[model samples]
Target: MKPHRHSLYRTFANAAAGVVHAFKTERNMKIHAAAALMVFIAAALLQLDLIRWLFLLLAVGLVFTAELINTAIEAVVDLVSPQVHPYARIAKDTAAGAVLVAAIVAVGIGIGVFYEPIRGWIGSLL
Candidate 1:
């Protein structure tokens, strides 16, 4: 006999719940959420062009997605290897590094996109 399989809707609902749980349980997800909100505000205040906004949103999405992937990787690694192991450590570290790289790139993009406008605003006041 085969084990029961969930319906499509049930699978989707489970996936959605996992995402919500990841957001709630993961500290980095909270940080990403905050950064995303900041980027949205900056986009509005800076009056970004459509193309700039698109790039900004894409960068933000990349960071968040990378973070989620990293969290999932860490969780699975922990589940599989509860005991301390060098390879498990390496796997988690590599996943974290990916997130870090994505975050750094996102920051670079944000600075590049917003710096000139922000500098001009300050220059006008000063």
Candidate 2:
């Protein structure tokens, strides 16, 4: 069936449904969401500068995008290859690797953003 052109609100609602579906179906997506929330809280508490906040946003967005793409890849792979196969394995593994790399990069960025404030806080407590 040809797709219908959705109204603006419906389009937004559909996008929100996709996000909810991902969070429901994908453990990694849920974890990324939690991490993102924590980062936002930290950024707020620390009153992170604009540059740092931008970096945090970029890192979080990358992870979210990577995870969504990974989910789509896995769903397509499963639909196309219902049985175990080497090529299917490769596709899923590669998609997972993309998420892993994004998560690692986000962690590195988080450290860069939080290190100084955290260290200073620790020093004050000592």
Report lDDT (CA) for all predictions. Answer: 0.90, 0.93
Model 2 gets an lDDT of 0.93
Position 42, candidate 1: lDDT: 79
On lDDT, the leading prediction is: 2
1-126 per-residue lDDT for model 1 (tens digits):
998999999999998887798789998889898988988897898788898898898898898888888988999999999999999999999999999999999999988888888999899899
Question: For each candidate, C-alpha RMSD in Å?
Answer: 2.1, 2.0
Cα lDDT of candidate 1 equals 0.90
Roughly what TM-score does model 2 have, to 2 decimal places?
Answer: 0.87
RMSD of 2: 2.0
Q: Which regions of candidate 2 deviate over 4 angstroms? A: 1-9
Error of 2 at 68 (Å): 0.5
Candidate 1 ranges beyond 4 A from true positions: 1-8
